[model samples]
Target: MARVPAGADLELDVQLEGVAEGVLVTASVVAPLAGDCARCLEPFTSVMQVRFQELFAPESAEPADADEQDAVESYPLDGSGQLDLEPALRDALVLELPLSPLCEDDCKGLCPECGVRLADAEPGHEHEQRGAMWAALKNYRAAGPEGSSAGEEAVPDGKAGPERTTDRTDTAPGQAGT
Candidate 1:
């Protein structure tokens, strides 16, 4: 959830060196990041510093070896050997962004029941939670007889049940009527 905003200005300190194949660019970037916290979901801003090195080479001369290929990039520099540094800067900065960003290391996040920001809540904040087995009992009052067969007594949960029938002629086989 963390990312750098588009159109944000980046501060760059760069060193250009002439290598055998191309111009090597070594740069350190300071970027402004804006993102939502993964836990508390609060908007926050932070600064990230990244260091990257890349070779801006002509597109015609492709690196032959896999290892060498990674060390050098085939970026088409302009006729004057001018470098386009945005892609290299983006790649380096994105790798350093935290996947699960938090407002703080000790952020408590939102309460499960009330959804209030737990960090802002009073000390020892909690709700009256029942155990799973007992928690299911609360639905009995509203659990109407959705699948109860005819002639069997409906569960007594302070709600109305079907009218009782005296005849057992229509009852399914082996099912006793009450």
Candidate 2:
């Protein structure tokens, strides 16, 4: 039916028999499914055969017991004793449909970094490693305020520069421990 999400075409080969309380409908449903593979995004098609048997109770009939009512699952027939098979067929086929259809058993899928399909990629396909962008900020902090080289004092002969202060008492205004 058109309700099938993956564009599947359904055909039902059905037989009906009258029972004591209802009509028993038996069918072999054949559906041709077409959709993309979940992992590889490749298109695929397959035939699915589902065997279904459901009891459609007459509209005037009532359950003999509460327990029987709870245990037995049956669809209701129309006032004229005609069964609408759409709901039963829809539920049966949908439940049998695959949650994630795959083109192959071992699909590698697409690369997260490059979006290239892994199956078609080279033997050692890889991207260059990128350093963190914040690393430059850390290097700048190590350099003095006047733009000295990292890890080296601004003054010559390894002496601490005027910008480099060891004394905590000489803190900048509004800073703690002044």
Candidate 3:
């Protein structure tokens, strides 16, 4: 509860049954929770009901068997034979709390590029295309087949103008004549 900044309002409906070695406690908690939406950062509130049963073993009681101890989870009673409910209540509520709360099921959230809320923005709202890493190629195409700039030479029929080779005579077997 301390970790959750907006602490929940807890209402517990509890029942206790005494056994030979321990007390069985059944609790249903109605908690009102408030937090900000994970996506759109909008504030939201909700009510969560969690029901759980746990065994509070007496301080003098030992496990009946290793398997029984391993299978069942039990909280230890205090030296005065009083059961502490805070830890149990904390566990039940915290487990049910939403990790990422949302104002609505499908929140569009904010635009990464402009930081504008997508929910409030006009439908089909978009910014002009900002060029990407290959933006120069786009501009090159926009400048026509002549070239991106007037100083540059025109490409020859969509092919490299001429074969510029070094003194090396190496060629793949099939590519020798081609």
The reply for model 1, stretches above 4 Å from the true place, is: 63-71, 128-178
Stretches of model 3 off by over 4 angstroms after superposition: 1-8, 79-81, 122-178
**How high is each candidate's TM-score?**
0.63, 0.57, 0.57
- lDDT of every predicted structure (CA atoms): 0.76, 0.73, 0.71
Residue by residue across 1-178, what tens digits does model 3's lDDT show? 1124355457889999997658889999887777887887767776778898888886556456778777777888767857798788778778888887776779888788787878889997676565453586777677755554443444432343344222223355347878
Give residue 38's lDDT in candidate 2 (0 to 100). Answer: 85
> Candidate 3 has what TM-score?
0.57
Clashing pairs in 3: none
Q: Write down the RMSD of candidate 2 (Cα, Å).
A: 10.9
Q: Which of the numbered candidates is closest to the native, going by highest lDDT?
A: 1
Model 2, position 125: C-alpha lDDT score: 71
Candidate 3, residue 78: the lDDT equals 66
Model 2: pairs clashing at backbone N, Cα or C within 3 Å: none
Model 2, global lDDT: 0.73
Model 1 global lDDT (CA atoms, 0 to 1) = 0.76
